[model samples]
Target: MLRFASLGSGSKGNATLIESGVNDKDTRILLDCGFSTKEVEGRLEKLGRTAESLTAIVITHEHSDHVSGAGRLSRKYNIPVWLTVGTSHACRDNDFYETHFINSHADFEIEALNLHPFPVPHDAREPCQFVFSDGASRLGVVTDLGYYTPHIISHLDKLDSLLLECNYDERMLLNGTYPHSLKKRVHGDKGHLDNKHASELLKKLDLNQLKNIVGMHVSEKNNTEEYASNALCEGLGCEQNAVSLASQAEGFSWREM
Candidate 1:
């Protein structure tokens, strides 16, 4: 079985825990480690896991909120970190357990899980998203991208589950307290996906095989759960409650595919 959960999500910090396989052969991959090492340990304890149990850590970019705890966790547990070369260099520190450079368009594996990385438009150096498979089910995670493209759609097609970003509401972002430059950065082409854009991307996907949808990277200041849920559900043609959201605090429980 392939199951995934988030330790936390949002600008403050983020970590995604995905597990596959059974018993002694299980493979646990962390997509991003954006918290303190101790904080990650505490959160993992909530899900009955430990940093020592992780198989690897895959970083999407060098953004602080997405890589704050990566080096420490990898060093403490002796797990490998996989990311593009640009992303690796952009990071301020290099004190990690081990670092593996990956191609944005390539596919790789770590025991039981296969990963496909696709380039994304973000302000960071060489940002990308991920899709994971255990040979039976596929989970696509797309966050921090400013917009979607046909190339992205092609990769996310036929996903069993997706964690898409719904960073802000259009009006709220324009009218919120963020400074002009900050607001522009968050709303620009290399910024984050707003509710409407994320919803539009969902509408273009093939959801015939979709079993789960989770809204990720929501802005606590410029967006609300109700607004995001309503927008995404409208595209999925499902009830608002059917789409679960990852919170900045508790994230969400694991869901199997």
Candidate 2:
């Protein structure tokens, strides 16, 4: 069987571990490394894993919350890292670890997982999200995104599971306490996915094959699990509980199609 879990996910840090294997082969990959090396190890230990269990690390962007610990982890564990050329340039000057680059637009395979890194509109040197498959079920992870592009919707159609961002509630953000500048950044074209916009994006996707839908990257002050899940449920025509929220502490549990 193929399964995955998040070590943690949020504004502070983010990491996802995916496992696929049966019989003679097993592969464990970390999607991002936002935590410090020891912190990542602790998180992994919480999930019954360790640093040596990971086959490689893949980064989505250069944001500190996504790449902060990536460099250190790779160096400590001597693991290969995959990212985009632009992302490489952004990190290269920093003497982090042994790294490799991939075209964000290309599709590649690693063991039993088919990996696809698609570009997204986020304020970074080069940011992309991922789609992973074990030849049967597909898991699409889209977070830290600004707006929903048609390409994203089309690519995410019929996914078995999705980890989509629902960063903030528009109303809360508009009326909340953030500075005017930060607020504008969060609401801008490359800011983040607001709850309402996330809901609208869900409406455009084909959820026929969807079994688990995760609302990720929620803002602590501007959003709530209740609000995000309810909005996505409504948009996807699913029950409230049918939609899950990936918390800052524990992202979510492993789910099957």
Which candidate has the highest lDDT of all? 1
Worst 10 residues of 2 by lDDT: 91-100
Q: How do the residues 1-257 of candidate 2 rate in per-residue lDDT, one tens digit apiece?
A: 66878888889888888778864357888998888888898888888788987888988988888888988788888888888978777763334556778788899987778898899998888899999988888889988888988998888999888888999999999899999998999999898999899999989988888877888888988888889988898889877878888787877766645
lDDT of each prediction vs. the true structure?
A: 0.92, 0.85
Q: How many residue pairs clash in each candidate?
A: 0, 0
Name the lDDT value of residue 45 in candidate 1.
Answer: 91
Error of 2 at 247 (Å): 1.2
RMSD of each: 0.7, 1.6
Q: Who wins the TM-score comparison?
A: 1
What's the TM-score of each model vs. the native?
Answer: 0.99, 0.95
